[model samples]
Target: MAYPIIFLLFLSLPFSSAKLNLDYYKATCPDFENIVKENVFIKQTAVSATAPGLLRLFFNDCITDGCDASILIASSAYNRHPERDANPNLSLSGDAFDIISKIKNNLELVCPGVVSCSDIVAQATRDLVKMVGGPYYKVRLGRKDSKVSDAKRVDVNLPTTKMTMDQIIEKFTAKKFTIREMVALNGAHTIGFTHCKEFSDRIYPKVDVTMHPKLAAGLRRVCQNYTVDTSMVAFNDMSSPNTFDNAYYKNILKGLGLMTSDYLLSVDPRTRPIVEEYAKDQQAFFVDFAKAMEKVSVLGVKTGNKGEVRNRCDQFNNNIPE
Candidate 1:
């Protein structure tokens, strides 16, 4: 069938060579990852939710012009708009930026000028995942901080909760991610929360048939007064709000997926099988997720002489040069 053909094509897609390697900082900064992990653990203790926030930050940064830390750039006096200013990125946690800044400061103390802000983000994402009981995967470093960031690009490239299966697939395919990879990456939803405004459509007008009736009722209760307070929130995976396990996929199987795209992974014929596989096998999900994360993290990356190591994670290197 079409599913098998698609799976074959996914297997056949050649991995892009981003020139990133595991040994990138071995000679220059052997303690790079340790510094990042230590800071992430310290921040995680104060805000238990920092893990998902950092994970989301990594995904946002990578999806837009690769994982060059472009998302970390703040709009300045010269340029009034940056990637984080975009509507799609408004939900991104400011804490993510703060945590990365903390890690960057500590790294500069030891490896002054050797580490890049982009690499800090990538490494911190891995450390955050491990801290939250997720699989520990090696991440290739050596990414440079991007100098350019545009708010417009985000609306064009980022996937939203309301996106249909086809739209989501097309977005991922543009980044060279396969359908299976897209599904696995969606599993990251296991640990995050969604704004009520983002999913109120499924609850109002009419209950989406895909959502479990009881789950839908609970959502309605949580969001009944959301209009008065747009900041109302709900966990993405009700089964396990903090764990990075296969519970997200299993929740979808039970019609408990919180987002429209989440529900579609099961209802759509092309993605359902992959979702079922992940629900049954957490290891399979983790393996595929790690591979996908590695691949996606390097999309459109700038290496060599392309970008610079930012002194401050929130500003361009040229804007605040050392």
Candidate 2:
């Protein structure tokens, strides 16, 4: 059950986007480096577990409204501004930054001021998924950096570390993703870690006790070894932890889910039947996942002269009159 919970939440609830030509990308884009900086910062923090979640956040934002750089900028300075605050949990992990640094170095040497960092952010996501073993759905590229970052929108759009199945459904459906797509997306969690602060509810208060009694005990056994505020609970679909695969559905059938969203798959009527079907066949999950990802990837790209291809992922309008 713990495994299944994680599977559902991870694969089913994580991310979403869409398509375009090269010319359309350049007109409405922002600097690619800044996006990398933000991605690096987010992946480094305790909220590092949120890398996948944040990926979805930006994707959704890009698709919903045009790839406005302001979408990622701060309107007002809060205690921890969106521009400055690394998610509390997975701060400064260096994993994402290391990758971004490599990409930036190569891009600096090769393309120089040609590629967009917004595209880099999108590419990093693709690279990470490939490294982890998921299908490499084509990223439409050419996303301009958004200057409008809204904290309230962050709360409204991003899935919490602790989210219910219903919450997940509502979020994905808004983007035109079907219930089956949500189930498959949960598979992404197969590779990441969950902090105790996020999943501790299962053990401390004893909500759904269907999990292995030893599971919680095992968690506590090494939980202290990790972050004082965290538990390095790995996702259950470990075989293809990084690879996007149907194994997550198979794991769900065996009751290997990790979180509330993961475990609820068997109970939720909308997703339950699909989980059952997917559990039996990996191909089905893969095919459906590709379709869903395709739907999400093409969200708000500037295909018809709406935006520009950002030379730098983080900066916008390098030649603007300042």
Candidate 3:
């Protein structure tokens, strides 16, 4: 299948949210939201990691190329490498991927090809947030899956734990996100775990001065041998790792943020106030996060013939006659 690389134009343009609708799948699949809700509940309850994994997967997909499901595409004979194979995306929660697959499979049984994987990502994300004690918001649907899924796209564009706060901000800004919005989106740290390797530098060789002594000592004890067992992990918010709330900002304010990108939210003057405000009020954080997630979900979105509704979330529908 012939494909075009996603252009820098996606970054350059102001995102248009006009095409998506709050009830996009209503007529086509009236049971859409319920389907996603059922699967997310089942997956999340059975696998404690499901909510965070799914949330991270949704974040990775949207940040890279709108909220299209290109991130879910597997490397195949037609395309030897896809976004999930990229180093930055390699840590995307398997439970997240599994839940999306579960939802897609269920949707097919009820509604056939009517629902797109991209929309599933958006809807599932919204449902999961509310399920995890975050504010609920309507996610506009009708986002079509992208035709392309190159590993190169993921390599060059995704944010990393190692990136400076300014660099991360630049990336989000290109997606039309304000610094306040970036801080709120990252409040997602309220639920997930990150591997020790992502923050080992702050604890090893020499302690990073920015970290609180207590936090540093704790991290060093847990991750001292991360080089040998790379699977060692730490929660982003030790206070309530399973809940989506303002505790992540509270942790950052106390110098307990798990990664450089996280720790700098309090140190960066432009973002500190937002972090402080959120830490003071969980409802405020929830409100801002809902708005931020809604905004980011539609950036550079593809609709109509710009993309297709894939039959399989894990591969393109190109082999079938278009």
Residue 129 alpha-carbon offset, candidate 2, angstroms: 2.7
Which residues of candidate 2, in runs, are more than 4 Å off?
1-19, 22-80, 83-93, 205-207, 224-233, 236-243, 302-322
Over 4 Å off in model 3, which ranges? Answer: 1-16, 319-322
Determine which window of 10 residues in candidate 1 has minimal summed lDDT.
9-18
Candidate 3 — what's its lDDT? Answer: 0.85
Superior by lDDT: candidate 2 or candidate 3: 3
Name the lDDT value of residue 86 in candidate 3: 90
**Lowest summed lDDT window (length 10), candidate 3:** 2-11
lDDT of 2 by residue, 253-314 (tens): 55556666777876788888988887787677667766766556555444323454444433
Which candidate model has the greater TM-score, 1 or 2? Answer: 1
| Candidate 1 displacement at residue 23 in angstroms | 2.4
Show model 1 residue runs off by greater than 4 Å: 1-18, 320-322
Best by TM-score: 3
- In terms of lDDT, model 1 sits at 0.85
* Candidate 3 Cα RMSD after full superposition onto the native fold (Å): 6.2
TM-score of 1: 0.91
